[model samples]
Target: MADRSPEVAEDVDVVVVGAGILGIYQLYRAREAGFTVRLLEQGNGVGGTWYWNRYPGCRFDSESYTYGYLFSEELWRDWEWSEEFAGQPETERYLNHVTDRFDLRRHIRFGSKVVAAVWDEESAGWTLNTEDGHIVRARHFVSTTGVLSVPQFPDVPGREDFAGEAYHTGLWPKEPVDFRGKRVAVIGTGSSGVQIAPAIADEVATLTVYQRTPSWATPLNNKPISAERQAELKAEFASIKETLEASNVGFLHEAHDRKTFEDTPEEREAFYEKIWRSPGFAKMTTNYTDMMLDDEANAEFCAFLEKKIRSLVDDEETADKLIPRNHAYGGLRPPFVTGYFEMFNKPHVELVSLREEPITRVTETGVETAKGLREYDIIVWATGFDFGTGALRRMGVTGTDGLELTEKWADGPITWIGVMASGFPNLFFPGGPHGAAGNNPRYGGTQVDFVTELLVHARDHGKRRIEVPRHAEEAWMTMIENFRQYSRFEEHGQYYGGNTAGKAKAFLLNPGGKPKMMEAIGEAVSSGYQGFLS
Candidate 1:
């Protein structure tokens, strides 16, 4: 739906900038609170990340059963997902279903990307500028721009000179991509590459994967949703939602209960095997109490994952090359997929680990590395995002007193709850630095729910603005630094740490302990949204 009013553009009670999960939910809550709302979306339609990332094998790492709106019991019962990890098209459909169900699309301005947002101190409102030079005003603004929305192009030499077609999984074409018989080269073995490689291998003439770091990937065991299972989960929707919020990452699963070293060697081995067989990212680590702490214990778990990779790949040489050796086992983000290892069996598929033979440059028709020039018909830079702070930086956002957010967060992002920044007033960010995301594996929907709660509170209350107190922001910043100080990633060795040669400084996850972060949020909600208020 497009807002095509003939009347002059004017102010609204609240401006929700995005039509993604977070932005949509914010509009729902704001409307419920009796506030007139307007939504601004950059794309032609909604579904934010789902709207953009339509590449082959792009799917949610979280289970489909729990990766949706929990605020409405009706919505939960009515909707159904067809797989453990829903693909992009299905995700888009789900968003459409929600939009139609709630009648939200009516207020959204499709294809309208917000170019600039300036706070007006005198008017006590915000002057927001869209790309087409349309200006609108709003008393309150909520930015639900996702953390991973921006795509990052690697700064490899001759990258722009490539004669072949180049595409990023994050910014895939809406139309169908034909890899019918073309040779394809995929660089970066992060989540996107891990998921797409096997699927593309089945179609492309020859597939070559340039691996900079071998990600720890587990089987999704993805399957269609069953009627009986859907019925069973729907019955327990409230309980599931509550349980998800209690855990880190806001999802439920079986994790190792005992300490890493509490069990005997054989017992630990048995536990590790059990989780490996389980579905999705939940199986990456058994509900282990100490895998996150205790260096020795974490090392033991890493060794287990390494062994699994070795056993899966038939070629010992390839197996060794694929296994991650240096960083802490759980340091880098985990990848969930199907048939990732089997792709190596294909005669035409080759794995070029950047560690051994560093890429020198991109040639006119191929990639030139220390080993040799590997030519391909198409190249996919699945190199991932400039995460957490990139979008805010790239857009040139200036906060109070003309303080630049990019310059302020030069080393890393500093936010109270990955939601609100100190100097930025009346601007609420749903997915900000140090935002409260847990390891429960079902964190996305919870993120939407939690952020909406704050937005609704701000709208409902008569307060004209809410800005994070400077002291509060500073305290939270200290906490983030302290957590990083104790974690394995304090030092930059590879991508997991702060440094990678060309890897942009992007740390999406909040480093603070989930439990403590959630506690702070609870305190806020109880105290009239504690941290920020007029």
Candidate 2:
């Protein structure tokens, strides 16, 4: 609900929503292009996900440098990441530094969330009203609302009855959460759960981790960047940027050119071991090309993972439970972990399998299940989000046909290369649904650049209305969904809007990855932007 008593409407050429990494970049592009841009963010600060998700061990799985903006050579040389993988604090600080360094903070409206956005037929623009009284009219409305902004909590009985402190990893507090000598319970075995469990295991007096499903864990193997390596990276900034843009998955690491069957039995073992030792998403991305697609190849990798977990954890059953059996190795988003399996080996830590003893409710003290009520001083909900299109669906945006965005995307999201929806005139939803499938910022930046190009085209052509024709939207959606068949993401699960209850199970990503997306954009540009109707 917006506040009553509105202020005078502020007109701008563009209004970019969500002041995350992508939002800040959009602001910079619009400003530099001579457009009066105003960025509205719900949070008090710039770091959107990093600002909220401060849970312990929350960090970048991607290479720190590759994930950061490669637009500016000066920026690449100036900022030195402490480690190969950066934690929440470092990531947040870096984003804030970038924002301040680029002078993007002034154009940002902190604490203002866009609640309602309406397309104006007569004005050929958009009227955006924030949660507060502020109003803005803009020719272009770009939403970098982001894929994982909205957190989703599972349906558990008596959730509010718990008197102890509860926190969702997606919305962690600014202040430090004390787990020392306290009985702590973590729910879900997703990426966040995998990270936080090992992090707090030593500190908590008794740590009970409730798992609904198992997650395949790989070593992050993160190390501090040496001074010499930093200098080398700085010197090779141009090549690095070129490599990232040219990459299929937007990662620095290149996949093995060979297929699974190309190598002999012993050779496969050596390669699997190499991938196991590799950090972050390298296990999946740098593995044999057929590892993601072929059942036998994926199983071979999973066997190695199972063996690794068994070796790490003392208990065989616990180790088996830690390894995913139902899904493929790279099917669901696997957690690249640090001591995740070994956390269960700790004397104070315990694992609770929901399959064996299902959780009945959350009592005042802790979670209760078929076994009994386990008392905990604090409960951490590591449950994931309604990823991709969650935030945009909640914006209450009315499109050209006087239908809300929620309704437009009710069946599923339909967009032109994940940039613009058909009925949404002059509205751009970048970095939300149907965009990136990997290395978010890298893929997200490409979409932002496309939107910026569209705006530039509009300005040059003296056209205000920018709409994705229904035919274009349909064609794009069809292509991306077809692309999903070959992707690493599990066909089901949250990848297809299955995370949120009753949401349409539609593909929300461009699984053809960066190359295919760029191809689509190139086609649109070559055809004189005919896909977009004004």
Backbone clash count, each prediction separately: 16, 0
Which runs in model 2 stand beyond 4 Å of their true positions? 1-6, 531-533
Give per-residue CA lDDT, model 1, range 232-314, as digits (tens). Answer: 88899888878876666555775666787789999899988877778776764454777767788878878888888887788
- Cα-based lDDT for every prediction: 0.75, 0.86
Worst 10 residues of 1 by lDDT: 490-499
lDDT of 2 by residue, 1-534 (tens): 122346857789999999888998888888988999988889888888989999999999999998998878898899999999999999999999999999888888888878899998999999888887789899889999898899989899989899989999999999999998999999988888989999999898999999987878789999999999999999999899999888878888877899888999899999888988888888878899888889898888888888888999998888767777678887778888898887888888899999889989998888999888899899999989998888998888998769888887878887877878878889987787878878889888988888898899989987878887788777788888687778666645678877678888888888777777888888888988885746
* Whole-structure CA lDDT of model 1: 0.75
Q: What TM-score, to 2 decimals, does candidate 1 have? A: 0.92
Q: Positional deviation of 95 in candidate 1, in angstroms?
A: 0.8
